[model samples]
Target: MKAIVKLVILLFCVTAFSQGQQHVEYKKVSNNLIKATYYFADNSNAIQSEGFFNDKNQLQGMWVSYDTEGNKTIIAYYDKGKKVGVWTYFKDDKINFVTYKDNKLIGVEEKALVVN
Candidate 1:
């Protein structure tokens, strides 16, 4: 009886820690662009990252990353694989905005996060 009980407990533990497999879905948007979305492994229907890739498989357009809980953690922009426009990063209670021109850092801005 004790051995059976131990086996049952072990099985329960294994199932508890097992997680669903994560996957990525790709879609062609234009001749030069393909959208890729990565989903979470826990089957929560949450996206880990979403972005566009150019024909050369280079990062292009807007890219966004989120935490496991579906909170946006980073927002970035790219053009022909070069960093362009403003990128926003969420860290703790702060939001940082960084500007880039031709992959060069141009400016930076920071603001406190407001919680409702």
Candidate 2:
């Protein structure tokens, strides 16, 4: 029963997220770089996420993601497509912070939401 409940909640979250899926937009920044942004189809046209890519089309710099209501949900840092530094994930009631290096998680901090 516990597993079934968890599955249901997971499915609900996935469905809700897919309903507001963002269409990615890519703009050439140079000979070998691109700036990417995502937009939802709800007519608001707000940026749902944005990031930068390097010459090899690998993610670099800071990548930020926003919820359907334009609330920031995540901020991740990458170096040449490898996850690095501390990544923060937000929700209404909880926050998860994880540190990574070379795409491997090195540390984590889970805390209650502090910012309203």
TM-score of each predicted structure versus truth:
0.74, 0.71
When summed lDDT is taken over every stretch of 10 residues in candidate 2, the lowest stretch is 39-48
lDDT of 1 by residue, 22-108 (tens): 788999999989999999877647899999999999999999999988889999999999999999999999999999999999999
Residues 1-116, candidate 2: write the lDDT tens digits: 99999999999999998777657788987886799998865644787899999999899989999987889999999999999999999978999999999999999999996664
List ranges where model 2 is wrong by over 4 Å.
Answer: 1-22, 30-32, 41-44
Best candidate (score: TM-score): 1
Model 2, residue 94: displacement in angstroms? 2.1
